[model samples]
Target: MQDLTKEPRLSKKQYLVVASMLFGLFFGAGNLIFPLHLGQIAGHNWLPAALGFLVTAVVLPLLSVLAISAVHAEGVYDVGRPLGRWFALLFMVLIHFTIGPLFGTPRTATVSFTTGVAPLLPKSWETGGLLLFSALFFLAAFLLSYKERKITSAVGKVLNPVFLVLLFFLFFVAYSHALGNPNAQAATTAYRNGGMSFFNGFLQGYNTMDALAGLAFGVTVVTAVRGLGLKREGSVAKVTAKAGVMATGAIGVVYLFLIVLGSMSVSHFKPSAEGGTAFNQVVTYYFGTAGHALLATLLTVTCLTTAVGLVAAFAQDFHKHFPVLSYVQWLALMAFASFLTANFGLETIIAWSTPMLMFLYPFCMVLILLSVTAHWFGRDPVVYTLTVGFTTIPAVLDMVASFPAVVSQSSVGVALTHFRDSFLPFASLGMGWVVPAVVGLVLGLGFHFASQRRQAGAATSNDVQPDNAD
Candidate 1:
């Protein structure tokens, strides 16, 4: 085995290549479809909506990578270790599970089915069609991720450009054809109108789930950086930050272009119930049957690349964290779970995952912010524990609040709803945890400083020692 402890380095050209790989990993799935739907719904308000989405989708994910890099940690699991071992393990497991088999992996197959294949298939074939498509999708992804040591090669080298070329082609046609006036559709309730548009878009961007995924992906990204030979901790962090910049810059442009496409198509297309449907409608209108083929091609490539990256990262983490299962076994488990979930259909998968997302995202945001600002509060474990602990009850409340009405109206749900609504500030706005987290952070800081002073005073007294040593 290679000495993992030894340092490695990369050249400028190789650096960019790996950076491009990061974008490829981040750019698939929601990166392709969500903004299009946002644009359609936002109508004339798409600009502000896009801004909002960018903050959560683009900004948060980038911050997540940087924060992980900043700490010189291996992954999100490491990020949580300072808080407590159990908490760290719990947080890590929840994040990986959420982004792995539960949502991210399965969505790749389901999304590819809807955006690429479903539009072309006969309506009668829908259920069975999804079954077959996802099976093939997961199989290809599993095999590639299972066998590949250089994970970036397949996704970065071959698949990314294939997807992007189609994307650029669509961007061209979307802007040039004037398929419909950009201002045709009125901004919907989901858009929340002009002033509120940004916040609404911000909320909508959470659907990308990239920020949470970033925590998981940091492990893969750092390993890729090291694999290229930049092995010193500082070098690793600096290089990883640069790569993160490139990834974000590239994807940011694509997301902006996609939002514009979404807006312009509004005049030409009716609002579809789902983002993928809107994507299908827009592509079909511009290119006809050939367009559907191109879309399916694009969706399949993007989804495949994403699934490969996710499974690769998940398998590595699970095996490292829980050693009973070897890496291959973990990969098989992920593939099997993802395959099973994908067959249930896209909406079903999303509906089931929402509660989980609600439970996880708040703490993730807390962790990232704390990781970055740790020095300011003396890097105290108390700080992490306070912020994250305070975040849990509200996060759980949000999770319960988001459940389907059948459950939300139950006794447990009724109690959660009352606690969330009656006491939690901005609970309905999806920020109920913010104040409590800050309060915990402040209290933690106070405790930290007080402890420091006491230590300092004890040292002073020990130095004097009332001449006992003499």
Candidate 2:
């Protein structure tokens, strides 16, 4: 095997480009639309809401990159290996599915079409239009990914700057003239006030799906850093951390601007079922006919780049796990799956995927937190096991409680859902897992410390007394 540690060093300019690529990769799909909706709905509470959204959406995803660096593991499963091999494999597969065919990948195509292409077509052509658009979109992503080695240069040097320029232009225009009253609604019942908006925002961040996707993206980032010629593990980690920070900062700025736009528009505009629709309204309100063309171009490129990244990540990881399938074969499979699922449309995808996200997000959050902070407990496997295992109890219940009406209506499901909601702290807020996770962390640490003390005492006794007598 080649020694990655001995790779050449990247110039500052090269490193910055990598950072740009990371931002663009994470900045697609829901990245653009979610916060605008939050802003529109949050109104006077936008500050608290944005803060909460940032914690999970921006903070956690950056931490994920650091977590990858902390472990120096090549893939996400390395973080999960402490739980045992089989469980790790299960987790890797589920996250890959979530970030791939089942949700994330398909979303890229759907969002691209809905936000970028759909407006150009008549309502009568919505279904066929999506099918045709997805076919072309996924095909382009597949072609770009076929030469995955160039992804960093291609995206960082090319696509990312275009994305940034257009987005910044939108922000400039938005700031130049306020579209609606700066003061608007307080919040919806879910976010009755500023303080409560934190948890609501946290849960809503799950919809961004970046936290899950970000873990998978770590490999892409690491590989890019390595490609920059940084050979030593520490050097690679250092660069990855720096790039993570830069990317996080960029994403934060983007989210803040978009959220502000969303918040200000609340007084004059109602949020559409899809936030993209609201985006169009705001853009057109200012730029008129030109905004439509600019938006379609912006959204299409953003979504295409994200799809390329997801497809590459999935195919590369899948090939590693199942070498019998070539990378191209895996890419072909992923692209086909994305093409098929995207035709189902954006709203339907969100509807089916949200329940799954509710189940898996808590698990991802615990994993990211533990992996990044593992050094505090000396990287003990028991601590990882305990924290991750205990979290599942509430996560599963939250799943049951939040399950779409289809499954929740079953008698047994209904009874269990009630038990969870009635018994768990924060269950009503869909955060039942938080308290249990903390308890699990405490207990795991307690066990670890006691065991260490017992071992130390036994060693002391042996040292003090017995060789001669024996």
Candidate 3:
């Protein structure tokens, strides 16, 4: 290995480039769509809603990156290891699947298709269009990710800047020519009450999935930092924190702008089915039919960079664990699986993803918070086990309640939903796990102190016995 002592810290230029790469990895499909959708829903209440969205989408994700750096974890497996080997393995698999072929990776393609290409085609052509688009998308991603070490250069130096330019240009035009009066737009029923609106926006942030992405992308980022000649763990962690802050700070600003743009669009156009369509409509309004090409280019470039990062991260982690497959083989498999899932269409993918997110986000949030504070608690396994255990029941209930109406309306679902709402605090707001998790943390801390005291007493007794014998 090269001498890391030569450069313990990244220079300012290197930091910016790395930060841009991190931003590229996080700013994909959900990042674009969710804020816009939240804006429309929140309307006159957008400020509180946007603030709430930033809590989960930006702040939590930033903390997650720092948590990985804090614990010096190579990936999610290490993050979950304190719970047990088996639990760590299971957590890793669930996270990769959620952020990989099952949901997130495919989402980039589907979102791109929905926002960029779908409008250009007839309604009947959507299925075939998505298939073709996603296939090509994953293929390009695979090719780029093949040279894993080049991911930062590809995304940061090339793709991310282009996406930003296009995105900012759209923002400039939208603001220059006011679309409508956001204050005049009535808030949606879900957002009519300010408190509920904030909570709803908080819950909606779960849809971005960046908090999960932060954990999943940890390995990729750590490796990049190491490549930059940072051998010391503390140096790596510090650099990671700085880069994460820079990257997420940019994402936060974009979210605010998108939410405002979405609210403004309400004057000129009714809210579309989703943020993708709303975004598309805004571009069309500004640039006319030709805007279709601009929107397509913007989304494709943005999504492709994320696809490359996700595929690279998944391949690296799986190969490290399984060893049965080469990194390239894992990359190929991930790209193909994501391509198949993308053909399910954006709406179907999103519908199915909501429940999975509800189940996963609670566990993820608990794990991340515990890891960040582990230093204070001595990194006790008991704390992790208790916190995660307490969070699990409500998380499962939330998942069941969030299933598509067809499944959630069943008798069993109805009973479970009733029980959850009756027993769990904030269940109606989609944050049923918060109270239980805090309770677990308190109980775990009490046990930790009790155990510590017992150990101290035993040591004192032993020391006195030796003195008496002497």
Comparing candidate 1 with candidate 3, which one achieves the higher lDDT?
3
Candidate 1 Cα misplacement greater than 4 A, ranges: 1-9, 180-185, 464-466
lDDT by candidate, in order shown: 0.83, 0.84, 0.90
Give the distance in Å from residue 117's predicted Cα in candidate 3 to where it truly belongs. 0.9
- Tens-place lDDT per residue, model 3, 67-116, is 89889988888899999999998998999998899999999999998899
Report the error of model 1 at residue 66, Å: 0.9
Query: Model 2 over residues 253-293: C-alpha lDDT tens digits?
Result: 88988888887887677756667988888888888878888
Question: In model 1, what lDDT does residue 323 have?
Answer: 93
Highest lDDT: which candidate? 3
Give the TM-score comparing model 1 with the true structure, all chains together: 0.95
TM-score of every candidate: 0.95, 0.96, 0.97
Error of 3 at 205 (Å): 0.5
What is candidate 3's CA lDDT for residue 24? 96
Stronger candidate by TM-score (2 vs 3): 3
Q: For each of the candidates, give the backbone clash count.
A: 5, 7, 0
CA error at residue 435 for candidate 3, angstroms: 0.9
